[model samples]
Target chain A: MASFDRHRNRRDNRVDTLSDTAIEGKDPDFDAWLSQQLQFHEPYLDNDGFCEQVMEQLPAPSRRSERRAARFQYGAVVAASAIVAWQFPFDRVWMEALQQSISLYSLVGVGILSSLAAMTGGILAARR
Target chain B: MDLNDGDLIRRVVDGDQRAYAQLVRRYQSQLRFSLRQLCDGDRGLADDMAQEAFIKAYKALPAFRGDARFSTWLYRIAYNLVMSHKRKKAPDVDQEAVDRARSEESVEEAQQLGMARDLDSAMKELSEAQRQAVHLCMQRGFSHEEAASIMKLPLGTVKSHVNRARAKLQTLLQAWREEVVSGQL
Candidate 1:
């Protein structure tokens, strides 16, 4: 096991350079030459303009006005939905009132129960 | 101005656009260097790829789990984008055409041209797994373990691909040298 460990360590230590040579089959001279060539080619490629282009495409959350506008839009939707939901039960009751005789107490009771249920649901969702 | 990349990402997630710009300035150079290497010195393509990477990273900032360095996470995005570009879009100068062009140049020019061709050839010849391992390890300077995370591969598998790709590239590069010298490429 000790001998095996020693052999593995030796193999691991030389792997990068040795592998470079063995796989390339170039003499050590050619390997050295290629390495130099790689270094030389490194600088010829210009890549300076990368950042500005990327920055331009990023979604800008720059201004407070934008935030306010977004918030207003969000609030408008929520308010519209709330208004629709609030008026829906009453709309049904009004239709029922037109169709037949209605008791004020019964209509008030139904409205109170529906409003309570909606309030409870809204509160639960908000907590979550 | 002096915020680290992680801090910038956090700020960006919190809707701070200026912090995002600062992050871009800090990483743009290194990203370009990495992309230039991957794109075989086509600065325009490298710039496009780097831009896409940053935009993607920015959009996905909220989902970043912070397990790796922000640069590592960004490099993973860049590497994936480059790989997709290579696979989907045809190269402007394909290897055969580039080799033909290389044959006409002086020895030093040939050497310069050959390095890119050889590296490109060697990289292209690799299996997808092997290519990814070599890209993460050699190109991005990730350790095998780090590459495993980026690649979502087992550590041993990443190690194996890196070893295999290195060996194969050595053989292919050596053959390439002989061919170029003999005018047989």
Candidate 2:
């Protein structure tokens, strides 16, 4: 058995990875014998730049989690926007603001802003 | 860092190409070796299939749910590739009938071939299912259930495949024991 083990060691390292009787109903002797024969045939193929070749040919690793997170974030934003749109009467608020803008105080503020804009434009035009 | 397969796969999902490369380096030998067995010692075909399997695994990495070991999943990919290649190459070959027809004949041939070409060639006589079961269960240290997962076969089917394969490869078993006793191995 020690010689068998020695032979296995001299061969592939991964042989005998499991203990004897690792699998139920498996004959340990038969398992060892078969494993040894299998080991004899098994070769530890070198990488030989295969990894690099595969890497070079790989399309790219996808950032799935990032994509998923982005999707969730976008979904949440849309959902939030929809909720706000549904929960708040934005149309009514807009109409009310528009109605209020037509009042005297808004007209006075607009007139002041218009006068200020005209003064600024006149000063800039004069400088030019 | 010597990260586990899970961590490496996680990194791969997160767009770390180096992590996927590490995963490839870790399993390429064993996967290629297994594919070589399935390819009937066609190393080029095995390497090509192995490369394709790795690329497919990389592309499908994000969908991997960590339910099975990464290596097992990768083996499953490789096995599917081999089976698909076989199907495409021999579209009319009935695998079930071939398995049944070769069950007894494989043993007889293994005994004869074991004398000349040794174990690997004798292994070729076994049906693809049995050979895959033997390779995964014995050489690769996967449990029967793990092998079933990798082969995408039922557990009982995988177990029976291993049993039937060992029965067919009885010649190799005897030759091995004899060689070990004689220190010929």
Candidate 3:
């Protein structure tokens, strides 16, 4: 907490310094030059039809309902998967299959596949 | 009376397409221009990033608490989008080369080109955080607090970035300042 406070105090000091530099006429010529340069770049962009393009790409106003439905669908999938996993011996079956195919090549293949799956899952989760 | 940003936001939250349109129209040019500067004048990539930012803003509108100004929030979304895009691409060799080239351009050489171009080149020479700080506070009229929120940095960090950016730009554009004093710029 002390560290956080120290950080906050430092930031406050910097903010004060920035305001002084910009607003207190400390360097009026540079401030004026910056403002003028900014203004000169202001009229370069023409946003013709840009808003329309954004609006057109937007999902319809039924986004709330769509999102709700998506949540419901996700919940259903999770519930169904949980039920099947609880009722089935899928894990035992997979272990037995792995035992049956217990060879150097098979183990190496499984290791590679597991690594790939983990990597893919990590990437997808990171994106989300 | 003109509808303020909050009112437009409220209407959009209530699913008013026209209100959202008004909000988009109000900010698109500024957002695009800022994104262009961030992307180092890559107009196409900037426009795409701006469009993606607006769409994300629309989707996230219901969660907006209005603690910050709408413009600040919009800029925050844009900044995040650009940052995420940069993360996905990973190695930005080209941008580094461009930055190196711009930094190499002397004040006198930039002055010979023109003040506006010189300013733009000098801006590209700043570190990313400094550039965003200057762009938001100096160019886009965001307060330091607002810029801090938009840049998702500590307030002090934003302030330091602004101060450092200003100092660097002041040094880089000193020649241009002399021209301005002479009424040549």
Instruction: Please report the candidate that would top DockQ against the real structure.
Output: 2
lDDT leaderboard ranking: 3, 2, 1
Give the number of the best model, judged by TM-score.
Answer: 3
Task: Give candidate 3's fnat, 2 decimals.
Answer: 0.34
The model with the greater TM-score, 1 or 2, is 2
How far does residue A80 in candidate 1 sit from its true spot (Å)? 40
DockQ of each: 0.10, 0.17, 0.13
lDDT string, candidate 1, B1-185, tens digits:
48777787766775667777788877787677667656665656767788888899988887899988888888889878987788787655456534543454334344545446456545566787877676667655677888887666798888778766766655555544656579885
The per-prediction tally of clashing pairs is 3, 0, 1
Provide the TM-score for each candidate, comma-separated. 0.48, 0.60, 0.62
lDDT per residue as tens, model 3, B66-185 = 888889899999999988887887675357544554565344344443555656666776898888888899888899999988888899998888777887666566666666678885
Better of 2 and 3 by DockQ: 2
- Residue-level lDDT of model 1, residues A6-123, one tens digit each, is 4335444444455544643445455444445444454433335655667677777657635654565556556755897776776776888868878778877887797677665654
Interface RMSD of each: 11.4, 8.8, 11.8
Error of 3 at A48 (Å): 3.6
lDDT of 3 at A46: 71
Writing each residue's lDDT as its tens digit, candidate 2 over B67-179 gives 88888888889989988998797765445545654564456445543333446555666788888899899888889999998878899999988876775555334545677
